[model samples]
Target: MNVMAKAEKKISSAFIYFFGSFGGILFGYDIGVMTGALPFLQADWHLENAASLVGWITSAVMFGAIFGGALAGQLSDKFGRRKMILMSAIVFVVFSVLSGVSPDMGEASAYYLIIVRMLLGLAVGAASALVPAYMSEMAPAKARGRLSGLNQTMIVSGMLLSYVVDFLLKDLPGEWAWRLMLGLAAVPALILFLGVLRLPESPRFLLRKGDEAQARKVLSYIRKNPAEIDQELASIKETAKEERQANQKTSWSSLFSGKYRYLVIAGVGVAAFQQFQGANAIFYYIPLIVQKATGQAASSNLMWPIVQGVILVVGSLVYMWIADKFNRRTLLMVGGAVMGLSFILPAVINWMMPNMNPMTIVVFLCIYVAFYSFTWAPLTWVLVGEIFPLAIRGRASGLASSFNWIGSWLVGLIFPIMTASMPQEAVFAIFGIICILGVIFVKTCVPETRGHTLEEIEEQGTNHGRVKASNPEN
Candidate 1:
């Protein structure tokens, strides 16, 4: 009986992690598919003279995400995270196909494609906000960081998958290649939608709705020990009861009140900096950057993103190993410092050795990617997932995610224009400075969340002065 129970427990836990992170795969695939598809579109459509159009095609998804994130957050709070995620998966499938089949109705083709991509972006944005929250609510305190980190790992893996898919499909003649790239996202979306049917709604969310019996039943399936399950249920109940007694409703405006102001700043700041530090620019334009540096055609440049993708995946693995073991602040500061140095050194080298091989910049980019994958990429999601109180988590996380997409939107929108007018080295140097500022922000403001339950973290927020001094579990 004991053996059977243990096996069932392990299988159930694995199921949760797998489907919980699957939303990230769709997110990554849609984001990366564009990187390879854009070149083909430009060629087929004769968009060489339309730099503004090119930027719009890439950034339209992000512009839609800003609204998607905000809307998904409020909806999840009302309907449940699992339902919102399931809905997003359906949206992913519908729009991904729409994006791929956009007819070449002359000048209208670009506009059609942009609209479809924006629709797809809405799904991606919802997943970005909801998945981490779902995972954090389901995870044990000791394993929460690693479980939340799984979302990032899946995100990078999806990106790498897209890069590999793009490489494999690059040889196909004409517009079919790009269409297939955009359309392939549907496979993962369908898988996520199917898989989610077997998963339970978040127990925390269930408790919030005043359904302790259902919440307890869900907890029993996920938790290994009966005593631990009881303890977790009690903790959740206590938190929810306290919130109910306060008799205050959580709304978008509540996020800006004095009580939540600092946390809002911290959450939104970290989320925004994660993008503004310029990682997506590399993911979106690696081929272009390599083309300029190596004088290679788009065909040959396809292989280069795979190399960066591998580095990103490997670095995320390293993060999984260390995430729970170290303080969040420590990891972010170390990653920020190293990442800044990686960007700064290449620019310095370019200035001092103007004749140096352009490949040197790529080398530094790999280093920057390594540290970033391990640190900012995964940790930012982890923090955002665990930081907010349940009362406002959905809305606050959504707003923070919206801020992230907004940053991504600006970067995607302006990167081509900026690179056209300024030296690439100068642009990277600016990102390097942002990385340094990230370090200061993590050190001075971010709280340590290791070994604490989501409820405990929420309680700590009521006394902001003690947040920085909180100790990690041994």
Candidate 2:
């Protein structure tokens, strides 16, 4: 009986990992597709090259994302996690296809493309909030961090997949190459949407929504003993009831009240800095950065991003092991400082020896990616899962993640213009500066969540505890 119970628990967890990681697939595909697609898309569509227009074409999704993240909490609360995921898949399919087909502004298809990207943004925002929340809820206390990290791992994998495909297809000599690249996203989106059809609704959402039977069934799939399932369900229901009685309603003011206020500030800052740390500038505009550093032709530059993506995938696993061993706050600071130093090295090398060996620049960039993949990539998601209580997790995480994506959008939209207008050396220097400041902010403000349970982390923040108690598991 005990062994069978363990097997069931393992299968349930595996289910969560597979479904949860699909969310990362969407994230990676969108992120990876745009980087290589943008320059060619802009050229092929004959779009106006205005900075603001470029920003719109690139970052317009943030606008819809702002709404998507803001509303995801309420909608998930009202509708169900599975429903919203299905909606996200539908949105992905619709907009991704449109983005590929959009003609220039004067053409009738121009506005349609913009609208689709904006819609895609909403899906990004919603999935960002929902997937992690769902995973956190489904995972056992012992495995939460690793399962949640799976989402980030999949995202980087997706990014790598995109880069490899783009490299393979770049020389096809037809505008359709980019379209096919963007359209490939629809395949996974459909599989994800269909997968959602079979996934059990999140037990937390079910319990919170007062669907006790469904919650019991779902809990049964995870917790083998009826007694354990009953106890857990009771605790969740009581927590849900107390949460409703305490708040009565969700509001913008809820973000600023008591302990939540500090969390809100910290959460938003973490999300913003995750992007502001200048990771996207590398991911979205690596070819441009590589071109500036190497003065290489366009064809030669396509391979650099693929190398970076591969390094990132390998780096994230090492970082995940570290995340389990060290204090998250310290890890974040060290990562920020490392990235800051990495950025400076390249900028200085480029300034001092513009014609330096391309291999040297590549080595520096690979180091930067190594630092980013292990620290910023997975830890950011871990913190988001740890910081908020179940009651406010959806809304708070949504808003924080939305801000992060918006920051990514801003960098992506502006990098081309910044590179064109500002010296590459200065821009890289500015990125280094931001990373340094991020180190300071994280060191002082972010809490260490390495071994603590999500509920414990919330209680620590609520009670204003100076430090989290060490986890026995660690």
Best by TM-score: 1
Cα lDDT tens digits for candidate 1, 55-74:
88998888888888778888
Candidate 2 runs further than 4 Å off: 1-13, 46-52, 104-111, 249-251, 257-261, 358-360, 389-395, 452-474
Where is the poorest 10-residue window by lDDT in model 2? 465-474
Please list all clashing residue pairs in model 1, or write none if there are none: none
Q: Show where candidate 1 strays beyond 4 Å.
A: 1-11, 209-213, 245-259, 389-395, 447-474
lDDT per residue for candidate 2 within 322-379, as digits (tens), equals 7677888877888888888877886788678887676665576677788888887788
lDDT score of residue 441 within candidate 2: 84
Question: Model 2: which residue pairs collide?
Answer: none
